[model samples]
Target: MKQDVDSAKAVMRELFAPTPLQHNLFLSDKYGARIFLKREDLSPVRSYKIRGAFNFFRKALAADDPAERFVCASAGNHAQGFAFVCRHFKKPGVVFMPVTTPPQKIDKTKAFGGDFIDVRLHGDIFDECYAAAKAHSKETGALMVPPFDHPDIIEGQATVAAEILDQLPGDANPDLFIIPVGGGGLSAGMTGYLGGRIGNESFVFCEPEGAPSLKESLTAGKRIKLDQVDNFVDGAAVAEIGSRNFDALKSFAADQVMLIAENAVCVTISELLNVEGVVLEPAGALAIAALEEMDRQSIAGKTVIVIVSGGNFDFERLPDVKERAMRHSGLKKYFILRMAQRPGALRDFLNMLGPEDDIARFEYLKKSARNFGSVLIGIETKRPENFDALTGAFDDAGLRYEDITDNEVLASLII
Candidate 1:
């Protein structure tokens, strides 16, 4: 373990220095506890992924008969890291990404690898791209640089834990460490290293509720592939936890893993962006959101470290981020209302709104050949309690409505 850590440090130094471990005064004051952020966002790739990528590249290159070609499938930070490492090691790489991947990510991956990496836009989903990447590797005899799962990658990621220990004052360990899990490389690596060194420190793993890969895997006592996944939080929206990662994390108590709602994570993204001018991608905000579910008493005075995984946020999606945040915070809601087609009916409904209520959206879904029109109404309010008041008003006014906020199918289509 010590030799592996030393190797990772030596390899990492060849590229860049360690990411900052800065104390977050704002968060500390807000939570009434000492809070520190492991600024993986400051890495050369703007993510800790480079650590694993470099480690994998170093180990592979050091082999007596190393493969000259490296391949990987990713549309996010991992692709960029892999590309960078391939270029750094003077190895050719083919990065397969879903065609639906944002152009920004594609450009970044290319920029990082220069001429050494080839970006292939494959199928519409990650699974499709992953299959293509694997098949390509088998056919071309190139080494597949797995995003996580691989021992070399895990060892590389474990360097983050070592850095945290070194960065702490007098080798002081954090009382609690909150880590975001995707394919589980980062979580598995940190836990494997830290669990070995400081067996007593508490660790909380955070995953998107829509893609609870790690949580589900642990519960099933095996790595189970999810049939469907919500990719809103793309960084941590893995359908299955990596097999190797699951092996490291499977022993953890179920309560140690926290599943955060996709929209709820958006709230943290917005908060960090607006308050601290810190741009955190959805997955990057996972660890911070877990703080809300934690027992205040348990973390009251303890030093806590939250890994801010990445900041490769696309600002063009700001409106979508704001919408999700509002919904999660209960400041916004959607409902299907049956409104009478009378002239004064709309006016009456508008008058029913409370002082703090505002209508953000009002669309007529259907009105042809009907006495009552189907209206899709979205409302925003200063407080969540305002929804109760609004509902009471609807009852008194003889308006019929159905809240479709929790209906995944209905909300996906219209909300």
Candidate 2:
């Protein structure tokens, strides 16, 4: 960090204004502690990824031939980031993305790059797309801008930490700094900058439960590659911690990193939007959700800073986010009920529901049975407790039902 971070910070002044580090009154009051959010969600690319991408462009052009084109592989945030950087530098860019990537992201990437980039949608996953980008770079002699794995990228991300140190209201420091981890670029950069300045224990790294690459890698004392990753939290759903990022973060104990459930993150997103009017992508909610897992009394009066990583939310996914939030809150449920084939069977089932319960979906999945029919039902309620009452009523009525709310197989089929 010896003047390197400061230099990065100075260079970034040529970029967009530093993203705000604002005190959140709602979160602070609830946590009974001072809470600040590094609003990287407000960045030009709506994510901190742009810092790394831009820095890669900055240093690469200075050190190598400025005429060398830039190439990168990403399906979402990084793609937009690289696209923006290519335009900023007026350099020709070649981006490779997964064919399965949503059109919303593809359009955004195209919009950001405009005349500066050529986008290729190839492969189905990131690794395959990355390989294709590399091949393109090799064939075209373009300089590849890695998303998170290089020294310049890490240095670029470290600028966020430098800004935080400067932006804090006073000559004060946060007792805890919570950061969301994916490829670990931001975590490594921030931790690297802060550890020597503040201390290692002050940092908390959060990763998605479905893709705990950083935590798993730290626990195993090596880079651990996950075979399968739930890409629901796409912004932070990396299957492996970046090698260079891991090197920067490996000094900390495994417990320093926390795994956040994907659904719990959705709950945080919904709460932030409904209560604070803050819209966040799933990864952006990770640091805030991690608060729920912390020892309340331990953090009661401490000052904390959470990096709200990105707000590049696609409104198209609002339904899915709301669904996950409802499931996490226990206010919505799905069940398969065994109903008698008699005339009043449907009426009796409806009668068992509480006044606050409303059936959202009801269909007979199996009607071939003579005595009973397999009915799939989705219910929503005003409060989570209403479900308890409804279940008790069903039990008393001798109704047989299988709660499929948490059943992944059933949820995939019906929810």
* Prediction RMSDs, each to the true structure: 1.7, 1.2
lDDT of 1: 0.89
**Candidate 1 C-alpha lDDT tens digits along 273-355:** 88999988888899999887777888887899999999889989899999989988989999999999988989999999999
TM-score of each: 0.96, 0.98
TM-score computed on alpha carbons, candidate 1: 0.96
lDDT of 2 by residue, 1-415 (tens): 7488888788888889999999998988888889899999999999999998988888888884574688999998899999999999899999999999989999999999999989998898888999999998889899888888898899899989999988998855689999999998998888888776778889899989999998889889999999999998888999988999999989988999899989999999999999989999999999999998898897898889999999989989899999998999899999899999999889988888888999989999997999999999999999999998999999999999999999888799777
Report residue 84 deviation for candidate 2 (angstroms). Answer: 0.8
Residue 69 lDDT in candidate 2: 89
Lowest lDDT block of 10, candidate 2: 59-68
